[model samples]
Target: MRILYVTTSFPVYSETFLQREARALIKAGVEIEIISLHAGENSFEGYPVIRFNKGSLLKLLYLLPLAFFRRGGALSAIAREMNVRKPASFLNFAENLLGFGAAIVLEKRIRDYAPDIVHCVWASAPAAFGMMAEALTGVRFSTGAHAYDIFEHGGDWLLQEKLKRAALVHVSTDVAADRIRDLCDSGKVKRIRRGLNALPQAREPRETCPSLRIVCVARLVEKKGFPYQLEIYRRLKEAGIDFEAKIIGDGPMEEEIAAGIKGLGLDDRVALTGRLSEEEVLEELQWADLLFHTGVVAASGDRDGLPNVVPEAMASGAVVIGSPVSGVVEAVEDGVTGFVCAPWEPERWVERCVELQVDAELRRRLSKSAREWVEREFVADRNTGYLLECLEVVSG
Candidate 1:
């Protein structure tokens, strides 16, 4: 069966989990194609993409009335949902209208491809687009709701419509699924963990080094708690802990993070390796003794459902110290597999890192357990097999 995957971004440096799952589905005998609202820097090697150019707002305004006439019933349904269920603000209304126009464009693509199923990777604008496409074409659609898309609001009026109409909604964590159950039918929501591409193999012990090699792989965003992590590193250095810290990934907060590092006088010890290739990330992880990922709830209520880097870090046997904010806590296992601390507790975070740095035996024990746990639960072939089964069940 042919499955069309729709998302806001394609070939993103940070969202390789989507590609991994699509590739796994292909291996399971399902033909897959991607349609993205915007294209990114890296290109997927084999999979084909239908990229929608973000045309000017004037052009979009001109097309909005045409889209409304083409899918008037769909627009009316969204309006009813907004009035009765979740009242959308003016901003939400504008965004939804824009998404509707995009969906009309996608409908033409869907009609041409005539896929067996439509799957949206994000439940925000992309899901709204999918909802409109399904309405216009009578083709079944499902959505994979990630962190921000599920939690944050953007024309949330459309979400209930999508939920009621979608054949299935896949969430990466039970925490996310439970929250979604409040908005839609409980039976339709499924928990499907995003799986990793590789499992680490047995290797010789990492040789002892003079300084602790610590790394953090995350976009420099408010929720990532990069500033908090830097403060903890500063205190570690002030306490005379010998270590070198490297942060991977970049975002709008690069200047803020740089300023924070400078303010704390951590420039000598800490470095921001802005946006590296996947190969470069693996190379950095190879020598790193610890992966400190501190995630927090942003002021906007955006938080991680589960960062793919958490499992990848564990698989690499980099003793993880993650934040116990959301679904991240489920993966860390507190003291067993790795350490978990409150996002607000810098002293505690520093204390744990220092303990792990000094005690090689403890690090080795946790790393072994972490890798074993990830290997057992996070295999793409196994997880995507279940995903395909869900697709079949829902389609039936």
Candidate 2:
């Protein structure tokens, strides 16, 4: 089957799951083309990509008129859809207009290359574009609702519209699917977990240093709950716990996190290693005794849909400690594969971290179970095979 992937950005370091999914799909003998509204820093590698200019607002304005003329019918249909659901504020109006213009141009580009299915990576702008494309060309489209795409950007009317138009709606976890179902009042959604291509071999009982090495691999963002993790680390330090922490990944919150680090006097105990390549991450995970992945509902209502780092850390034989957010809950069974704690309770997090630090046997037991769980459920080929099954059924 042929699939057209519409996305906000291509080959993002933060969204490697997208690249993995594409690779898995291609390996399964399905034809795929990618179109990113905004280009990314990473190379597109093997896939054929159609990347658009998302640079200057002035340049985008200059192209809007041409886009309108090129696919006027599609733009009008999109405008009507937006008008019914979007707020009437100036910013919202302009944003909708710009989206419509882009969708118009995108629709023209897609018309001649009609594929069996249009799969939107996120249920945000790409899904909007896919909906417009479907309306214009009568082609089938579907979307995967991840975190902010479904919570922060989705609305009652907007989700209803997408649900009605889309062939299938995939969410990463059953908890996320349940939340969106509550909003859209639709039973058409499916749960499809993102999978990892290769997992680190589970560590056997081996002697290590006395100090526990903890690692957290996540973007420095609000939803990631970096500050809470920092607080947990601080409390652990104050309690004279023998541990060192490293936070991987980078984002807009770097400066803020740095300030927090300085203020808490955690410079000696914790380190932030900006963004690292996959190889570097795996190297860090290999030696780490524990992986702390804390997710929270940010002020914008954005949260994680099972942070990819959880399974990565689990497969690496690091005992996982996660927040009680919906997706985290699904991945971590308390005292089983991993431990779950409330984001607000630094004390609780500290206690759990301390337990993992002092008890080597407990850590090994959990690590073994975690790796087994990951191997059983998160193999990329099996998960993407299920995704392909969904696509084939939708295409038919």
Candidate 3:
């Protein structure tokens, strides 16, 4: 079957769920093509990619006037605060007013390709464009809801209409599935957890030292709670705990986080490696004794929908510790696969880290259980198989 996957961006530095899913689909003997806004010149596991030029300059020009005069807040202000809000909202209005002129251009491409199903990754402007293309070409369409799509943009009437018309909808976790059911029909929603590529063989075993090493593989952002993790590290230092920490991702909050690390005198104990390739991440995982992830709901209400890092770390045989937010509880078994801490509690986080560091037997047990859990439930092949099954059923 020919499938057309639509998303906002492609082959970004941070590997997202859609990229992993597309790779898995190709491996599973499915014909897949992806169209997305251009990030850079990179191929996704040899899949065909069509990149659209993002009109950021034009968007900025359009937003400038609205920011100065509009009462409901200008597009510039909204865009500054949220990445998808202004551009998507403004583009949607433009598409509707112009009778889907931009969407018509995409529809021509879709008609030439003649896909059996159009799979959109998020409920944003791209999904709207995909919905229009499907209507024009008579192709079946579906969508996979992520945390930002469901919690941030799902309430838009146009997005809700697309959800109502889709043959099937996929969500990363049961918590997100429940929210989708509230917005649309329960029968149409399916829970398909995100997956990752298989873990590589460890290069070397962790060091046999009293001081344990912990790592957090996430972007430095407000939602990721990197500052809170820093606080936890500071407390660990004060308590004279023997451990090292590494953060392996880059984002907007890098400068602030660097300042924090310097002010707290954790320069020697903590290392901030900007970004690493997938192989590099797995290598670091092999060297680390444990994974410390303190994800929480941001001030803007953006929460976790079961981070892919959790499963990747687990599959790599690292004991996981995460916050008990929306979908994290599903991945972590609380003392079985990993430990769950309360959000924003640095003391609790430090306590868990210290306990796991002190107990070698517990770490071994949790590592074995964690690896088994991911192999059984969260492997990329198994998750994408379920997605393809849903597509077949939906398109029938």
TM-scores vs. true structure, each candidate: 0.91, 0.90, 0.86
Model 3 deviation from the true structure expressed as Cα RMSD, one decimal place: 6.9
Error of 3 at 209 (Å): 4.6
Alpha carbon deviation, residue 352, candidate 2 (Å): 1.8
Tell me the deviation in Å of residue 271 in model 3: 1.3
Question: What's the best-to-worst order under lDDT?
Answer: 1, 2, 3
Q: Superposing all C-alpha atoms, what RMSD in Å does each candidate have to the true structure?
A: 2.7, 3.1, 6.9
Q: How close is candidate 2 to the true structure, as a TM-score?
A: 0.90
Candidate 3, 337: how far from true, in Å?
0.8
* lDDT per residue as tens, model 1, 1-396: 778888777878889888788778878889877777756533467567777666744565555577678777876786667566553455455555555567776566788888888888877666777787777787788998768766654326567677777889998887788767877888989888989766655442254646888899998888999878988898889888899999999999999999999999999999999999877887777778888888888876678888888888788868788888889877899889899987678889878877886677888888888888888888898999998899888766
Arranged by TM-score, best first: 1, 2, 3
In model 2, the clashing pairs are none
For residues 14-116, write the lDDT of model 3, one tens digit per residue: 6566777888888888887777653534466665577765453344354434434532342233233333334335544543322223344555577788888
Q: What's the lDDT for all of these models?
A: 0.79, 0.77, 0.73
Candidate number that wins on lDDT, 1 or 3: 1
For model 1, the run of ten residues with the poorest summed lDDT = 200-209
